[model samples]
Target: MVIADLLGVAKVAAITLNERGRISHWDDTATELFGVAPPRALGRPPAALLRLPREHRGAFEPGGFGHVWCGACTLPRVDDGEPAEVGWWVYPIGGTPGERGVSVLALAADLRRLRRDGIGITIGDLLLAPPDRPAGDAAPARRPAAARLLRVEPALTEPSGDGADTFAA
Candidate 1:
């Protein structure tokens, strides 16, 4: 069983697709996220499950590179409940030569809490992509509007060795 399946939570989902865009793995989290069980989603086109927009669907094609896209939007469900507004990230996921596949990793949290408190966590230098196209076709694809690169540094300061020092000096 995958990590999501073992956890049995609906907060995160993971899916892998091949050159043909067929589903390779669909864990429990994915089932809850998309509302489609593995038996039904497996072997099906990624578009069928996600129903991505036409322009965005092309980006999911296997082996296609040079762009990163993301959005903070809501996902609609047919069940008798309100739609879910989520923060999502999407990008190409392969580095092997001649390999063609894209992996989409998504994490969803309560929107209310986010709106009230903002993201309290500190994020380091992030490599954000420009909104416009790069100068030349050879130029690396621009980062998506929502993309942010965070550089995290470990907190290494320790308490002073002095007997009474309770904080780092």
Candidate 2:
């Protein structure tokens, strides 16, 4: 019930995949975003059915290097289909997505957004793809995976004329 409520309340499209890459949970926003209804979409491979690249398949595997994977991808131009340069993330945690075996929470965008705006690396970019370096240059050292997850509280305030004072960095 809690999982359904959270996914249902999400304003964006959210998809949860089973261990075999089949669609286990598809939110209402996903129906609107992908033009596919639930129950019908269940047990279907999202990559092949939706024409998405298979690079994200690594997100659901056990003993995976990371918990989050972000990348820019293009969705096929179906009947006036979704965004082209949309960014998505695979958040495979223990308790989130749906209750069952390991679930991979895949969030996709329908607009031309480059990346997730506010959901930055509160957990640090541990297994993220390393940045590009010039020729002959050694790769930068990876940061220690010691930064704890940061919890943020969204606050709303009336216009105080002093803009930018409402949010804390």
Per-residue lDDT of candidate 2, residues 1-169 (tens digit)? 1111111011346787776667888877677666678876788867655766677556644335357887766766433675555557678766543557546777765544213332222222332222232445544434334322233323333544766554443
Write down the TM-score of every candidate: 0.49, 0.50
Each prediction's whole-model lDDT (CA): 0.48, 0.54
lDDT (Cα, tens digit) per residue for candidate 1, span 1-169:
1111111111335566655667776777566655678888877776776655466565555556435556655555424344655555555565542343435333334354345434322112221222232434343332322333232322344534676534323
The weakest ten consecutive residues by lDDT in model 2 span 1-10
Evaluate model 1: give its TM-score: 0.49
lDDT of 2 at 131: 25
Model 2 Cα RMSD, Å? 15.9
